[model samples]
Target chain A: MILPRLVFESLLNRRSTIVLTLITIAFSVALLLGVEKVRQDTRYSFSNTVSGTDLIVGARSGNLPLLLYSVFHIGNASNNISWQSYQHIRKNKKVAWSIPISLGDSHRGFRVLGTNSDYFKFYRHGNKQQLDFEHGKPFAALFDVVIGADVAKKLNYTLGKKIILSHGVGKVSFSDHDDKPFAVVGILKKTGTPVDRTVHVSLQAIEAIHLDWQTGYKNPAHAVSAKQALKLELEPKTITAFMLGLTSRLSVFSLQRSINQYSKEPLLAVLPGATLQELWSLFGLAESALLIITVFVVLSGLLGMLTAILASLNERRRELAILRSVGARPWHILVMLCAEAGLLTAGGIFVGVALYYLIIIAAAPVVETRYGLTLTLTGLSINNVCMLLITQVAGILIGLIPGIRAYRMALNNGITIRL
Target chain B: MKNQFISIVMLMVLTACEEPVNSESLQATWEDLIQEGFTPKELILKYQIDTYEADDPRRMQLIRAMEEEWNSAPVNENLDNKKITLTGFIVPLEIESNAAYPTVSEFLLVPFLGACIHVPPPPANQLVYVKMESPIAMPNDGEAFSVTGIMKTESVNNELAEAGYNMKGLSLETFSNESLNPNTE
Candidate 1:
């Protein structure tokens, strides 16, 4: 009963040094937990980018590159699938519906996706969740565009706002589509996917924007005004890739097979989930490395606590000698020191958990906008709980070091020890 | 009791007097043919490539050319325009676009289960394109069914695969053990 009282009073006596140690441990714990949350959430966000589609068909290329360019709006396609090929696949009796994605253009720095109404009708993400509008409706006119939540928030776009897109995918644009500026007709609710950073427009709008430009050059002789271009038939000659939803899940392989062996143009079809698994395998090494680094950080924090306790053990020899004079055994001294270390660690963990929530709440908006990560305020997952338990066990082990030292000092420093 | 009896008699008389239209079409027997002979695996074996790499443009080019050549590969001509009933697994191609409850209208009937789920699909001769008059709700694509249809040895080239035979489906029902029995010689 008195053991805890003694330990608490002793810790309170050296509150400054103990507080410093607590802060260090708390910060380290927060860092570790934060890293884990980001890693898990990042994977969840990436995998949940596209769903309800059976196959992601693109030009013949590596699966990862195709996935990156088509779904993530990252990098660029080496070749585009011809419009005829897209039409052919769309008309296939097996396909329930399809969304033809025409990428390459960018509004400011965000990716511009040229698609038809089918994109809004059939496109799904994050476990078959449909795209819901935050404001206004989908792009109905040729010049109307739908901005994503991140895009609208970042660029401060409101409905009916005017914006121009650049021809290429690069951040730095040499030429812009100044002739035909699109009006923001819609803003989509955030999905925590790359879709949140995209700008959606009609397929014909893409063709109209490029009518004045030819092969990356603005030709004055072939200049077509936006009004004149609108009057002409603006059919997209090619597309970046497309996503297909098949009627039967079993026909996915057959349809994928058919798309792959599509004789008209060499095309490749990949199951999104299967290709995503392949992507994870490629990224597995980096994920493991991140976990290892966080583990080391946690170990260093525990070591810091051990150092603080062991250093304080030297100054407390006289107090231990006094306790020995009063008939307290060497094992009691051991228990007191261990208890103090354990209490400090438990307190630090509590503070760390509190700090983690604070930082997450504060940084949620910035993280989502900058990294497209949706940090949910969830309780400690199974893996995290195990990590915490492991940390506590290691703390107990670390406490043993100073505990044994205090035990040996109590026996050596008899009651009549000369100061 | 008398009123109920009279009403039942009048209903029977009315139903009996009605001429049964399309009775011949519904009652006609179909010739039972073995599906094993449709796709000769030996013919496809010769045309198979070792592996197809994504990076190699030439491999895909060769595959495209090989696929064209494979389309001309010999197929059974006797199955053309014959009223035939065959039991096989379905690989749906077109479905009604009801997100809640979808039904398959166009599908490719394959002899084996899971012909196109994961592994490479069978050759053109092994595949039969079947289009039903009305879409039927298939519990799953892997479930086998018996399709009675007019089979024509017409080569169908869709973006996904090529089928050597096409069938205009007349009726379809889930496969039963008794379906394997030859109904007609």
Candidate 2:
């Protein structure tokens, strides 16, 4: 009891210095935890975006670029694969299902994806979870469109709301497909992926809107009305990319090899998992660098506390000597110093955890909306708890330095004021 | 001092809770996976593979026959449902989402490095589809792992049918040269 009182009184005497050291420790702990959380959540968000699909096939391009453009909607495809080639490949006996997607269109900054009903039936994300409808069903009519949760929320679209798409993939487009407007029939539930930023319609609808824009601009002389265009042939000539689900997982590599070696066209087939692993390998160095820096920040914070305590030992030698003359054991002095360190470390950790939650609560929504990465709000993970424990242990060990020094001085100069 | 002792004991208990490697697991070599007396080199020689021109129709027939033989190759029934440890390179089948690292949950364990990308893949007997109990960080290309699991002789068939062994992986460890030549022990 006396040890704790003595430790508290001593800390209060050095309140200003102690408070600054506490803040340094708290901030470093918060930074370390924050970096770890962001790294984990980013990986989680990206990985959960696409699943169950065995392969993503596109016109000859790098695997990472194809994955980004086709699945994540982060970039544009280099070229389009001929519809004939897609049809021929889908005819293979090993293909369980296929979903072809056509890009290069936008509606109010959101990408417009052209696909058939197979997109809803076969596409999966996050542990084989199927996409569920929030409001309506899949697109039934040729001109009926389906919007994702984010697009619907941001744009304030509802069932039967008519919206026209732009010809090019940009926030603001010069050419709008005003002649052919699509009615929103379905709204998908929030997936926390790029799917929430997509507008989906049938391949025919995509072709219909571009009927008069063959030469990259509207040809008014030969323009077809929306009603007339619906009656004409609307088979898609090309598709940006397609996803494939194989009948057997074992055939994936062999099928990918065949597709890559296809004599008729230059194409690339990549396993989504393998390509994702490759992408993470590219970021592995950066992620490790961030973690290492945060660790050093934590080390410096502890070192600061050490430096302050060691410097204060000189001034406190008289106080310790007087206590020794009053029959205080040398071990009692040691325990008091240890107790002070333990309290500061525990307090710093508590404040740091509170601060971490405060920052996460404020930034989660912004991160989700801006990057499509959801920051999950949960209790501290096991890893975080372990790290905090290790930090506390380190803090106590640092206390032993000042503790032993004071013990030696109290024994040598009992009741003597050593200036 | 008593509290310190208790915390140390608690740590020991926590570590002890992890699943231990089964002591009864049989060490299996890649050769044990293949059908007895069937060699790829001998098969190629018997089919006169080197003599055929690139466009020869007979060569195509021989290739098809070889594929059929490879698919139909029987797995060792003695090893079925037995706890076994085998070392091989990995070809990831399923990767877990939301992981800070690229962790693989399901993968194919092949007898040779580059088996997935190379022109010729191992036969059905030589391929083991491993489903891990927990995901592991993705290993570098050509890195080998010693996997312990219960081996099952299962045929996965679709329109284009394929047959291979399945393994419910219990544990995985990095394979070293010491594991290859156990006589050194």
- Fnat per candidate, as a fraction, reads 0.08, 0.33
Chain B, per-candidate TM-score: 0.53, 0.65
lDDT of 1 at A355: 97
Off by over 4 Å in 1: A172-174, B1-185
Predicted candidate 2 versus true structure: per-residue lDDT over A80-147, tens digit per residue: 99999999999999899999999999998899999999999999998788999999999988789999
| Tens digits of lDDT, candidate 2, B1-185 | 99999999999998876433465888888777766645566567766766888799988988888767765677776676788989888877677875554478888887775444546556567778888878888887657788999887655563432456778898889987754553222
* Best-fitting candidate, scored by TM-score: 2
Residue by residue across A1-419, what tens digits does model 1's lDDT show? 68999989988999999998888888888888898887667666665677767789999998889988899887788899999999989899878899998988887888899999999999887656899999999988889999999899888999999988887777668778898888999999988789889999999998888776765688788788878977899899999899998754445665788888889998999776556655666666887898899889888988999999888777777888888888899899888877887888888888888999999999998887666678877787777778877887788778889999888777776776656
Chain A TM-score of prediction number 2: 0.95
> For each candidate, what is the lDDT?
0.76, 0.84
User: iRMS for model 2?
Assistant: 2.5
